[model samples]
Target: MTNYDEVPYPDFIHPATHPGNMAAIARLHGVNAPPPESCRVLELACGPGGNLISLATLLPSSHFEGVDFAAGHVKTGNAMIGKLGLTNIQLHHAKIEDWVTHPESEQDRFDYIIAHGVYSWVPEEVRQSILAICQMRLSANGIALISYNTYPGWHQRQMARDMMRYHADGIEDPHKRLRHGKALLSSVAQNVPQGSAYRVALEEELKALDQANEAYISHEQFEDTNRPCYFHEFAAEAGAQCLQVIAEADWGDSTYEQVRPDVASALASLPKIRRGQTLDFFRRRTFRQTLVCHESVAVSEQLQSADMASMHFVTSSSLQGDQITGSNGLSGTVEDPTTRQAMECLVAEYPASMSYQELCEVVETEEPRSLATLQTDLFNLVCVGLVSVSASPTEVRREVSSHPRALPLAREQVLRGDTVTNLRHQPIRLDDTTAHLIRCCDGETDHAGLVERMVAYSMANGGLVEGDQVVTGEESLRVLVTAKMTSNLQRLAAMALLVG
Candidate 1:
């Protein structure tokens, strides 16, 4: 089995912030003031606390207890809980299967059991043990989420893994292994035809990755246990305990698009088997964090899709602050341009939020239904960071940056440079001319003083300032500074990075 035991788990972004979880939660339970404070969420192999912490932040009342054998990760998570001041979460430095199944244990049955990144990592015995615990500890109507590496998708990844293994065989150093793997791929490009499907796809993926910033890539690839799963196989394993798939994380992604049209169509044609097969087919699924439930309880014959867009948005693992629509959060048909446009507008103002009522108004839909109409739009808006949910009307915030990923890398650049001193991670990428403009944010510098400095900087450079500046005149310059400063402030507030 390739001995993945030694591989360190990927340093994944916490699941609380995971789009998959956010999407799944929205699907499982709406912002609909959950069932009860007594409901317990049990997570297995909850590495380093990102997922649990994020969920804790979202639902302050729920009791979340997670277990992992990786003590170091538990310690790191404990530190984050202290930093974040989350009170409802508890971390245990033991494997969950051991803890739950141990004799003399006093803990009650759990209402929700989430085991993401588990089934594929541990050996089959450990997985079965975990399943047995879920069956024993889960309450009626309880949900036990067990995410594994699904098949079809696993095929491509294994091909990539084969390449990696072939390139780095017998290489003990992790750095050397990584470099060797990447270098070997680069080497093969020279011999391969440029336009071939594999060649073209690999090149484009590499280029897109190169364009991605350091934090983004590090968060993505440099993990310990990034493995794949087989769909039907994992479901069959879970079924041992009467646990079944209720839905997937980013549930809509589990829709027609991720699956082949014919496959989806064929599944749609069948009844229980097709539904069960679709639930089982996580093989092709790249990253899954599903929401599972008891075989008898949560699967209702009602067949009500509460809100796909909203559920997907909050559960989505993507932190780009992009908006989503339909199925997951609030439901709407994208075939309707008003619905699409409404979602675009909401996402267009991320970190800054839009009211459900206001969104419907913007889409030009009629009154009463407008609120209902905007529901899905707002749900989708949650995915991309275009909108945030908050308590009060005045507390809402917004940002106008077109390229969000560039912001972090750009802020680092601004901080390192001597010209933009006393600034600590603000600008969403300021050009040299605009760089001079952002210093005005310190509150000491007035708008006129900023404009004068911007002009002086522009004059020094040839028509454009340093690092891809455009010469559209002072009016444009003022607009750029004002717009970015406003956007940065809003984003900072959303992240609690700013005061006042």
Candidate 2:
């Protein structure tokens, strides 16, 4: 009915939805979460199983199960799983409410329960059933990640949604409805007064909608049901189901720095739910990815450095003078000398994670400091979101091997589409040339062989070109291909695509 079979939701991996990262956050909050390496994971409404499949490939020992109402999505995902020859994961075509009847659901409990992008989009009954499943199927100390839209940030988006629905009223075709809705919004955004606050908000929404794919726009803007609620209300609902809100998946979102000092102090004086609600009001958060656990589990309110000793740290941030500039456009300053040295170690190990003990050993070689000081500095970095902490290190190779082999999932994805998931559970778009190059990296082809295959591929597809001009000589073309191969290999390794 929603045109999901026609244009399925884009296959993607949400980094925050990764169980290892969730476990890290859980442990930071003093929950003895099950280890992600060998834990059982379940995903509700896991359309095409993109996120779960990636996790299964990365952690071979772990078992994964997904339930989706769409038969096409389940078929596509299971086909990919079969192609990959993975024995650890399966995607079932079943409704979320009926998942309790599934054999996997009846036999074992899941350590991590993920229900991303389903809460606000589904009906009230389905939403309650999702929470009920989390309570029934979750193991003791297991964490459940549930993402949904929040207010009052959505208030502006709601106005835009009303406009879109008004313009596309009575349109039975989903694609037609989406197109007309976007056109009306675009016209309004351009004609509105330039300096008005409403105009700015409209323009922002328009920009985001324009960049999204058709499937995303169809579900997000034109869905029949898009209910958003306050954080406190959502917490109350979860509490009624014997679950408690532990922490936000994105650590920085819940921090006090989002608002002014006085506002934060006022918020701190309120009850926990009231504090979260008031903070959301101050920050105007549009969406939330919240982690919940059994109500009996003791969640620590204060974070200590010792909590991080068992974790691994990863970052794609560079040391620019005293600032740590992350690839995600967020930056933080490293004023302390010891912290600066520690950041350098992390920068050198981008695309690969370093264990706490390994980082301590490396950082202390030149700048010896108290272990407590180092842990405290790293903890501050985590709070600021410059560095990501995970329960286990991602096994992505940083260096380019002579016979480089990408993960089978990425290699398979490159053949099917322009996007592939990296070891970090993030998508990377591949160009035609890069895709051709990656197809040749089967762990049996050397650098010279890769260049030869790429040259042949380019010549067969479209003649080789240097800069804006086509190359004339075979020797020059080979040389160009060699240079391109070297650069692309390093780039691929940096993107965490190369596994060997």
lDDT of each: 0.51, 0.86
Error (Å) of candidate 2 at residue 357 is: 1.1
Lowest-lDDT window of 10 residues in candidate 2?
99-108
List residue ranges in candidate 1 displaced over 4 A.
Answer: 1-10, 14-39, 102-107, 193-227, 258-266, 272-284, 298-484, 493-500
Q: Model 2: residues >4 Å from true position, as ranges?
A: 100-107, 365-369, 461-476
Compute each candidate's TM-score over C-alphas. 0.62, 0.94
Residue 491 shift from truth in candidate 1, angstroms: 3.9
The count of backbone overlaps in candidate 1 is: 57
Query: For candidate 1, lDDT tens digit of each residue in 142-223?
Result: 6566666666655655555566567777777655666676676666755688788788645654564457543333323444
The sequence of per-residue lDDT tens digits that candidate 2 reaches over residues 102-197 is: 236434788999999999999999999999989888888999999999999999889999999999999988789988998988888789899888
- Measured by lDDT, the strongest candidate is 2
Please give the distance, in angstroms, between residue 403's alpha carbon in candidate 2 and its true position after superposition: 1.3
Candidate 2 residue-wise lDDT at 118: 94
Give the per-residue Cα lDDT of candidate 2 at 24: 92
